[model samples]
Target: MINKVQILSVTLPGNLDAYIRIANLWPMLSIEEEKSLTQRLRYNSDLDAAKKLILSHLRFVIHISRNYSGYGLPQADLIQEGNIGLMKAVRRFNPEIGVRLVSFAVHWIKSEIHEYVLRNWRIVKVATTKSQRKLFFNLRKTKKRLGWFNEEEIKIVAKELGVSSKDVREMESRMAAQDVTFNPLPEEDFVDGKNNNTIQYLQDKTSNFACRVEKDNWEEHATNKLSNALLGLDKRSRDIIYARWLDKNQKNTLQTIANNYGISAERVRQLEKNAMKKLRIAIEA
Candidate 1:
């Protein structure tokens, strides 16, 4: 049995160096040892078997965490998330899966870290759709230059990631943009010639009051315009727009709505487009 205290005591000075050292220590289990341990956990619900499997794979998690350091998250936190993923993989692993534990565990580990990166990388999530997630990962690998992807590169990425070219371009634009703080700079507004932090800059009473009033006025005008525009719409058109666009879980698609009204899908599309254009113009006016 490996000494838990001894392993805990061997902390390398730096995170990357620590992970590298841990990677070198990943133990190789024989075929019989691997099969026996997996069976014990899978069939017998053996806690000890699960612990042994997790303990042996800690080094692999460390190795995997090193690859994600470029995402700018804390190394220790990434390693911890990877460890949690490793445990999940161990729990769900089937002995009949006919693959090594390490191979199956890699997906789980990376999934956990990828989720962490997406959630924390920006104030809002960078990758929300399936295509965006594919682009998010592949873009990191396929990118060779600092600027946007060219036409040829976009085609290549779309084919490689199994997404449309338009999706690839949109995701590329999103990845290139950086998140900026909403508040103003400290040096831009100073009192008594004293320097202030961003927190202090936000404390300016006049600026905060003006911003709140502006936002309130905008919302009031927008709401009133929307009400007026909807009133101008015929009853059926208003119902269709409300059902398809405003409802939380409405079950009306263009084809469904067309069938209900004995109209073609093209006609439905045209109506929907005209309605949207009118709504936009009304709100802006």
Candidate 2:
């Protein structure tokens, strides 16, 4: 058996092509040989056997890591993370289960790459739910063929991806949206670094300021119309309406207004109701 310490001392090539060549040159172990090494490491804590098992499996991690390079992360870092996951899988592998290590370790390998992509992709997380995650990873492939999804395309994608049409539309909007700076510049500020441009941090597309302002303006206009409608009521009706809603304290109810005006509660309620109808009509008009 090769000495574990000596194996660690030797520098492994970082380049993928060279590592692939080295892994290809390693002679494939028979089942009996693999089982024997696994037993020695598992029972006797034999470091040399564990080292051999890990070295033989390095090629599989490299191959799997290549598929995740589309996420714009460094290829070398992705492979390194995949290698860590491979080591973890090797430690937990049970040769008695009658499965190849590659098959079992593929899950572990992809899991690590997925975590890496999520962590580095944005300052804010993109996907939290399982369905959203599947959409996040697979939606790119579905959208690659066309410019954007039509209604028919959205339905097909939703069925194929196992998500709701609403969820697919949400993810589509998220993907199409670009992150803008919180304090976006006028193109002149970027020419020189004098601007304290730290607000160039990532902006949340879901909370657009323009949309919020528009909503606020609409609410303010509706409130003004309501105030105007109340002013058109008779003095007593208007007083009763103000006491019910706009008074700061000791807000008068129908009984309280009736006591103040020496009228029955039913009469006070009638006046309030009629005032409300007139206000609604005025606002509608």
Candidate 3:
């Protein structure tokens, strides 16, 4: 009996509050009205019928979006994503299935909102697997207190959710961990652009990448020279150098080398010094 889009000529307000007010002001459709609109859109591709169904459901999307406010994403974004879900539900609704549009649309609405929450809730995703995702959304409600879960509580939650206690603890730890600010804020104490033991080192500058590349290149270059220098030495000298510095165990003392060579420790030390000088000269050359 009423033209739903009467305010089409009126430019919609750009603010969230005004958009929510408009959504709330939209009148709810009757059962018969909804069925007729759904049938028209489903059978004949009636654009006006689809538009009415979507407009009537915006308030429902806003209601569902409010449930995710704890996630700290923008309210407008949540509602916008939920509205997409509502549209999808409307597109797939079959009148012969004998279910209310609201009943069918709730799943679609929450699905979009859940995806939005997971994607933007944190800098790093806390839930990746099926079990972790279940923990992410339901763990908040299962939590009985304001602090970390005790051993008994963890076991209870794990049993209740059908997940391991380790998983529960891991998810809880992930939830408790706050994102670190990579760069120093303007108010941070930087002495000559340096902050000691701070997250300032986490800043991903282009220069830092270049420095790492250069360091790797120099180390590789030095390793090549050292390998060539070792080859130039006599068998005994090479064995002495390898036993002294290149041995991973670090158990080859001067006396151990001398014992194997049947020479005095002093002789071993002098040979080491002479071999190191020759290697240095060969490397620098």
Candidate 4:
């Protein structure tokens, strides 16, 4: 007979079709089961309980990930980020809070996916502020399907989203702007050109092999030094630094980290500042 506690692992596949099939294969837990498992994980920190919770919710992650498919990112990557959010949700779940796991997990899950999409949707970042991010994922879709918004329509969108018409117009301009590609490849995509001619036209003596090699070596050494400096700091300092700067378009808020670590946001800020100073000194040396 199988034990009362279930221990199923989620092995996501590169073939999204198979992944969906396997994800949906994990039977969703009933309300009672969800409540009980959350209790076990919360009260006892039971690893099996956590595993069971994560497996049961894999299908939810897949479903939510589908909503982001239009971003033209790999489906597997979106699902993986959703899985991370689900795991975090599971870690902090509270059955006593009187809400289902899925309800609580949705915010965390979307937060992760949103960061991933914003960071990757363009070579140059398209969304930096809150309103811009809102328009990028929400209003931009409307523009894609319906074409440009009229003045009246822009006002309507602004009212609905609680922003100024000027904000919407600015986003419209940004969306319409064409991206410029820097560092165009030399001759690889050319229809007809001599290799030496292409190289001569595209690169100067300053772009010689020696300079390129030195640049790459210096970058690698600097990265290693930064890594070592981060390792020297305590875990909290490392986490704060990554969340604030290293992780571009970070979704982790200062208040959220402070709450998680049971400290003040001011304290978190000070820690981040000190950590950055240490890193700068280490890197400069």
Candidate 5:
């Protein structure tokens, strides 16, 4: 068996030929050998056993990472990410589970590669939420043809995936979209002298320094006035306002506040309305 240093010396190759040559060095492990090594690592924390387990699986990582080549990322990077997942799987593997390590590790391997693709595939993130991520990965596999899905096809996919048709359409659009550089090169000029790049045209005018300063000053003044008005209120009214609005995590409903104060919900509502009126008057004054 190859030692840890020998295994570490092996570098991921740029071309297929070199990769194949390096992969040939690490032989696959037999079932008995694999079980023994895993058991040693699990019971004794044997570093050598863990090293052998990981080394034997490096070729498998290469094989799995190749499936993600369509994402336009470097194959070496994908394999590197998959190797991380493989090591994690090795650490968590149970020899008594009656499953081959490869069978269990495949999920971990693909997940790392998938995360890498999602993170680096586009300049802007295509999928942020759990449902969006599910839609993003499954959309390609579910498509019958190469082109965009038609209206009927979209509905079928939406129903099958338990998401809205609008969400399906949005994910399809995102999948079809390509990343564009935020700033264009100097030579990439339009027919007119003005640059046509998004950076030049898409800037938010309201985000200018002077405008931001003016907005901040107005907010500060309003906040100061509100604070003074709250101080002028009676204790009960102040507490009600705090519980209902000002407390970030504990905004109480009218019924809850009423229960606490031994009053009806309607009475609480009336007091809240009256307090708000007083606040408006105080701020205006």
Candidate 6:
């Protein structure tokens, strides 16, 4: 039986180089030996048998993780997630099913790596629905060149994938989109050496103190005129306007205002519209 600490020491390497060296140490098991060990682990909960199975498969996990290197995520992290899936496959593997352990474990390993890639590939998710997720991973392989797909190629891909040409176009657009930071870093600057942050461009340069004061005076004058206009209206129209628009906390609906006044909804709407027209004339005057 292998020592638990010894197995842990070799299986968990400090770096990729050490990981490759450690994986090479474990020899592949024959069908007979694998069945015997699998039976032992399955029926008796043998820790040594489980450890041997995991150690022998570390090389396979490393191989699978390499395929996902183009995603720009750390290779070591991908291998780690694949390792978790390999362990899960080992736990549920039925040796009686007449398939090799490697064949059974491949699905589990790829699933884990796919999940990791989708989660860490970008800040915003590239795929949300089932078809989008399928298109996201498979679309890259369909493209033969570095440039965008032509119309004939788009039709071919759409028919092959069982999706519309429009969907293919949309996914292609999303794939081309790159993430940009909302704010520029300290080192980032314009050609003239001024800070080029988004905040600098977002400020309203036309809103000076004089412009703000003039706008405020106009607003005050409009409020006074509107108040005088409301006073000129009958009590019912004044109450309906106040309830429908002036009250910030709880604006009443036309139906609710109609119920309050014992009138129909159409009457309430008419009254509100007339009130607005009078206010507009008063303010304009």
- Candidate 5 — number of clashing residue pairs? 0
* Cα lDDT computed for each candidate against the true fold: 0.78, 0.79, 0.84, 0.82, 0.85, 0.83
> Residues 36-90, candidate 6, lDDT per residue (tens digit)?
8888877777878888998898999999998888778988889888987888778
Off by over 4 Å in 3: 1-13, 144-146, 185-285
* Candidate 4 local distance difference test against the native: 0.82
Q: Give the TM-score comparing model 6 with the true structure, all chains together.
A: 0.64
Q: What is candidate 5's lDDT per residue for 1-285, written digit by digit as tens?
A: 224323433356668567766765888999999999999988887878888898888889888887778778988889888888887788889999999999999989988888898899888999889899889878877763546888998898899899999999898888888877667776775537766577766767656898789999999999999999999999989989999999999889999999999999999899999999999999999
In model 4, the runs with Cα more than 4 Å from the true position are 1-11, 188-285
- Give lDDT: candidate 4, residue 249: 72
For residues 25-46, could you state the per-residue lDDT of candidate 1 as single tens digits?
Answer: 6576787888899998888877
Indicate whether candidate 1 or candidate 6 has the larger TM-score. Answer: 6
Report the number of the highest-lDDT candidate.
5
Q: 225-278, model 4: which lDDT tens digit per residue?
A: 989998889998998888777886766888988998999999998988898899
Winning model by TM-score: 5
Spell out the clash pairs found in candidate 3.
none
Tens digits of lDDT, candidate 3, 1-285: 123232222223569999989988889999999999999978887768878898898899888898888777889888888987887888888877988899999999998888888888888999988788889888976663536789998998899899999999999999888986556466765657666436645565646777889999999999999999999999999999999999898859999889998999999999999999999999999
Indicate whether candidate 3 or candidate 5 has the larger TM-score. Answer: 5
TM-score result, candidate 4: 0.61
Off by over 4 Å in 6: 1-12, 144-146, 189-196, 199-285
- Candidate 3: lDDT over CA atoms? 0.84
TM-scores, all candidates, are: 0.58, 0.58, 0.63, 0.61, 0.66, 0.64
What's every prediction's RMSD, in angstroms? 17.6, 11.6, 14.6, 23.2, 13.2, 10.6
lDDT: the better of candidates 1 and 5: 5
